[model samples]
Target: MSISTDHTQLQRQLYLLGYSHALPSDGVVLVSTLLKDLQASLDRVKELEASTVRLEREERTTRLGHDKAKGELHALRTENNSLRAEVLGHSREADRLRRESRADQYRLSKVADDLRMANLQLKAESAELSRSLGDCQRRCEARLSELDPRGKIPRMTVNRPFDVSRLQTHKTQVQPAIVDLVDLSSRRISALEHEIEHLEDKLSTSGVELKAAQMEVKERDLELMRMNSEYERMNPAQDVGDSQVPRLTDQVDYLHERAEALEKEAKDQREQFAKEKEDLHRRWVAAENDRVAAGDASWWRQAV
Candidate 1:
C-alpha cells in the first residue's frame, strides 16, 4: 500500500516538475527498479505465507497426535483403575477367607481338646466300673462256695454273717447296670468320634477353598502386571522419546510454542519487509526528483 502511495506521489511530483509529458530515462529506470523490488517483496511474502501454512498444517498434525496420545493414556488409566479395583476386591476376599480359615482352625482345636477330655473321662469311668465288677464277682463266688455242702475249702476264722439275700440281689442288678454303662460309654465315644471326623472334613474343605482363593489372587496379580506392561508398550511417546508421559506432553507443548514463535517471526519479517519497502519507495521518489531538478544529470552528461 505504501508503494502505491509513493508511486502516486512520485507521479504528482513529476507532473508538478513539468516532466510528466516526457518521462526521462531516469524515471523509467527508477519505475522499473521499483516494480522489480515490489515483485521480489511479493515473492518473499508468498514464501512466508506458504511457510506459515506448512507450519500450521504440521501443528495441526501434531495436535491430533497429542490428542490421540491423551485419549489412549486416559483409556490405559481407566483400565488400570479397573484392574486395581478388582485386585483390591480380591485382596479383601482373600483376607476374609483367611480370617474364616483361622476361625475354623480355632474351633477345630477347641473341639479336639473337648474330645481329648471326653476320652480321658470315659477311660477313668471304664476303669472304675471294671474294678467294681471284679469285686462283685469275687464276693458272689465266696458266698456260693460257703453254701456248698462239700467241706473241701476251709472258711475264714471271722464269724461274720454271709448275707445271701444281698449277694443274690446285687448279682442280678449290678450286671445289667454295668453292661448298660459300657454300652452308653461306647455310644458316646462313637458319637464324639463321628463329630470330630465331620469337623476335620470341614476344615479340609476350608483349606482347599483358601488355597483356591490364593491361587486366584496370584493369577489376578500376574494379569495386572501383564496389562501394565502392555500399556507401557502401547505408549508411543514412552517407547520412542521419553520414559515418562508428562515429558512427552511437555515436548508437544514445546512444539506448539515453537510453531507459534515461527509464525510470529514470519509476521515480524513481513512487517519489516513492508517498512523497508516503504523506505525504498520514499528514497526512490527523492532520487528521481533530485535527478529531474538537476536537469536529468545522466542524460546531460551522456549528451556531452
Candidate 2:
C-alpha cells in the first residue's frame, strides 16, 4: 500500500515539475537523483509482482489439497452407507434363521412326542409277542421232556433236533401262525427303526442348518465390530450420530444369545431322543431273552 501511494505521489510531482516554468538552480542534479529513485521503485514493483505470482501458485496447491480431502470424505461416506446396508441385510437373515430355528424346534418336539407314543405302543406289542413266544417254547419244551426226561439223545434220531442227516433228520416245523406273527413283529420293528432313523437324519440336517446360521450370525457380529472400529478410525464425520453403534451392538448380542439357545435346545432334544431309543432297545433285548429263557432255542442246545 505504501508503494502504491508513493508511485501516485511521484506521478503528481513529476507532472507539476514538468509543467512549471521556473526551474531551480540544481534542477539537473535533482532530476538525475529522482530518476534513479524511480528506477529503484520500478525494480521493487517487479519483485512484488513475482511474489504475488508465487503466492497465487501456493493458493492453487492448497485448493487442490482441499479438493482431494473432499473426494476422500465422499468415498468414506459411500463406504459407510454400503456397510449399513449390509448390516440391515444381516439383520434380516438373522430373523429368517430365527424363524427356521423355531420351526425346527417345533418339529423336533412333535417328532419326539410321536416317537414316545410309538415306543409305548410297540412296547405293549413286544410284551405280547414275548408271552406268545414264551408259551410256544414252553409247550415244545414239555413235549421234549416227555420224550427225553434226562435230556439224553433218543434212540430214534429222526425225532431229534439238529439231526441234519437224511436218515436221521427230523423236520422242525414252525407253525404258519407263529411264523406270520414273527414276520409281522419283524416288519413292525423294522418300520419303527426306519422311521426313527429318518427322524434322526432330519434332526441332523436341521442341526447342521442351525449351526450354519449361527456361524453366519457370528460373522455378521464380527463385521459389526469391525464397522465400529472403522467408525472410530474415521472420527471426523458426525453425520451419523453415535446412537447407531450401540443399537446395532445390542442387536448383535441378542442374535448371538438366541442362536446359542437354539443350539442348546437342539442338543437337549437329541440327547432325549437317544435315551428313548436306548430304553426301547433295552426292552426289546429283554423280551428276546425272556423268549429264549423259556426254551425257544433250547432244543438245538440240547442236541449239540
TM-score for candidate 2, residues paired by index:
0.38
Instruction: Give stretches of model 1 more than 4 Å off.
Output: 1-22, 149-304
RMSD of 2: 12.5
Clashing pairs for model 1 are none
So what's the TM-score on candidate 1?
A: 0.45
Least accurate stretch of 10 residues (summed lDDT) in model 2? 161-170
> Model 1, poorest ten-residue lDDT window?
156-165
Scored against the true structure, residue 49 in model 2 reaches a CA lDDT of 100
* Model 2 agreement with the true structure over 1-304: per-residue lDDT tens digits: 8655555555557676684444344464565577789889999999999999999998898767656654554454445444544544444454445544544555555455545545564455445554454555677777888887888433332233221122122234334453245356556556655655665665566566556655665665565556555554444467346626554665576567657656865776677678767866876887678667657556774686
* Candidate 1, 1-304: lDDT as tens digits: 8656666666766687575664454465586577678779999999999999999999898777666766665565455445544544444454445444544554555455445545554555455555555666677668877798575354334245332223434433333344345456557657766765665666566666656655665665466455545545655554544435553554465456556655765675576568657856875786578558557665775696
Superposed by TM-score, candidate 2 places the C-alpha of residue 11 at a distance from the truth, in angstroms, of: 16
